[model samples]
Target: MTETVVANPFEQAQAGRPTGPLVQGFEVIIGFETHAQLSTESKIFSRASTAFGAEPNTQACAVDLALPGTLPVMNKGAVERAIKLGLALGSHIAPRSVFARKNYFYPDLPKGYQISQFEIPVVQGGTVSFFVGDELKSVRLVRAHLEEDAGKSLHENFIGQSGIDLNRAGTPLLEIVTEPDMRSTAEAVAYAKELHKIVTWIGICDGNMQEGSFRCDANVSVRRPGEPLGTRREIKNLNSFRFMQQAIDYEIRWQIGEIEDGRKIQQATVLFDPDTGETRAMRTKEDAADYRYFPDPDLPPLAIAQEWIDRVKAGMPELPRAMAERYVRDHGLSEYDAAQLTQSVALARYFDEAVSKGATPKLASNWITGEIARRLNAQEIGIEAAPVKASQLGQLIARISDGTIPNSAARVVFDALWSGEGSEVDAIIAAKDLKPMNDTGALEKIIDGVLATNQKNIDEYRAGKDKAFNALVGQVMKASQGKANPAQVNALLKAKLG
Candidate 1:
């Protein structure tokens, strides 16, 4: 079969525009099609359970197996999830949408044709915005449609024969498609993460890459600057974010190398071999016409009312973008900090609770994104599983803000709290004698001693050397055994130098 290449309107608009950074003198173009398994209990078109890890062929009922007398029925839960996604992404939810039969033949597809949305999808026209390392980027989405998943073709266990597991048959999925808008692998991965966050935050999908619940297919191509889009090769089923990045980067380089060697990129689907860090062609990609898509007679067109959409919208939690904006507006956080805090629902909740418990916004942000995040990453746990409670962290931060403890002392208190050696922030501070030396006369004596011993540093400070001033402050802190208030030390040192 001949390869079919589809033109991207986004790329067409980029004609003659200033192109972004190039890979081997060719601009990289990428788009994504992600399949997020709807978090429903039953299959999209059948009553069979959609739970994972079930035995092979056991979950397939008459409707899932396409029995002669059985007819497919739409799952209400799946349709509601579609609405939730549309609302979450600011997409237009079609009042009426149709399901079509995507005709294909595979051993695992007992029905021989997969039911999906084609001509009229349920969601259309949305934008996913995320920061690719400080610079904000937005990717335009074409559509997100409801569909059913096919069974898995197991090839590992049997020798010379493949097994089919129908446990995933007729499972609900939302295939979210995007325009060819990303210019780099970084942007592509960021867009995928943002999309994953939205689907999971809205309770539509679990966003589990390991269980085949969330998967991405990246369409990658490279073309010279200001040229028409290149013929694309799709890398399919990138289950891990790390693998997704590796796969896309490798594909871009390979495409560029092929062009330099006078080879034309073939439109095809490829799989990423994580072990070798290479992508190999699986099949020549097909166009829409190749599938012969036609409305499924077994399932009727889905009709959604405005009332239903409004109901779903009302029940939806505050989205990440909105929460981030609130952080910027109400809490006075930078856009970057706001975005980082809202990476997950649990993390955002932790920040909010900490703030509510009297933690200063910027200080709380610094602590959580800095020390707390480092520890969480080291332990491979979410913020919800943190050893320090939100209230405890808030109280600790309050102590730092109130001049009762220096920032250095706060770390010691934090360590004590995290290790379960102490629970109350105040108790920990008292046990460690972490409270700063608050006595004005005693602090003055310590500062005088530091200034007398560090005469060279004091002389340099008077000669306008800022590092010398910092050295004097450090000397004071050292003499006070790290119990001196840093602000007080800085003020005293500057006065003595003058």
Candidate 2:
């Protein structure tokens, strides 16, 4: 007997919307379900420590174990964190939300059923906006619900037998679900990254993928542009952003191949093997009905008052989107530059401090996003750990703005400062003799010598060749031992040629 495939609710909600760009003549529809572990110190329904890396089963209390006569109690901190997320995403926080038992039998789930929100979640109808290589894309959010995490099934260190770790059981989690709004792998990855940033920025989750503080499950499907949505296969527990992209791309190709070969796509849960760079089915995916969801009898309904939400809003930090807009509005930065600067709180604060110290906003942005970012990534460190402080960078930019040193010379000072060769920006400039040649007479003489020797380039320049003009400028700079200011060289050369 054939099983009935349940249609994705997001696809139905987005019907008649323009289909995304096609891959192999079929459009891809993708959605996400991300579990962000809240930063609370205890489990959602118990007081067990939520700290990671504890010995297996040591942290599981009687409540987590679902012992007979044990009652589940709600954690107020978990609820506040949920409210923070809803406010950050501009989602609707339901005044009354219900917790239902998702009935399943897994060794890790000691309760035989997991408590999660089904019919009425805490957050609803939000949007996650991000940039996909300069073009802005916004993915609609379905809901973000409060839930308790299940324990882990450890397959390693056991011969032909798996071990269950209940230490992670009952940990507080906010499972954020997104609509089928992503069309390509790039968009999906960008959406995930933006969501991760929001959660981490607001201090609700640690956003640590390696430690399992945050995880993503991708639902990917493909269909003809005008046809109804195809059955989707979910790629489970993608921890790394790179792996997430790889998994989704491979799944899209695999689904298209199956449809072309006259086979129907099956709804299942698949896992990506990084060793082989492929996705293999783990098990058949279950629909909501299969879980037999029902409200839990032990726990009462969660009802949040407006006054409590207001208090959370009052204590919230400046959100990334708002901060980005402020950068663009007050500092005259491009949207892309602002977005890049606001990627993290530390980076954004560094930029702000540099600007506050009188560095030109545009120059500080270019240096921070270019050289500083490159160095940070190469060393695998954050902006807070940079050898050169914000004040030092601000001084460096000031030198460039005042024409005391060219950008090329400023970089030499930057290297000296970054490598601990010099402590002060001006001291490095003085010690390395990196100050640009400021004498107008000396610059004119250098230009004269360049023009007399490079007559071919001069002729080419007069014949409307822009490259030749640049070549003459290069010769003048080289003759000046690379200490000539680029703007001065250009102006002097143009005056002499005319």
For each of the candidates, the C-alpha root-mean-square deviation to the true structure, in angstroms, is 3.4, 3.7
lDDT of 2 by residue, 345-381 (tens): 9989899888887699999999999999999999999
Per-residue alpha-carbon lDDT of candidate 1 for residues 254-289, written as tens digits (9 for 90 to 100): 998898999899999999999999999999998888
State the displacement of the C-alpha of residue 25, model 2, in Å, after optimal TM-score superposition.
0.7
**TM, every model:** 0.96, 0.96
Name the 10 consecutive residues with the lowest summed lDDT in model 1.
1-10
For residue 475, model 1's alpha carbon misses the true position, in angstroms, by 0.7
TM-score of 2: 0.96
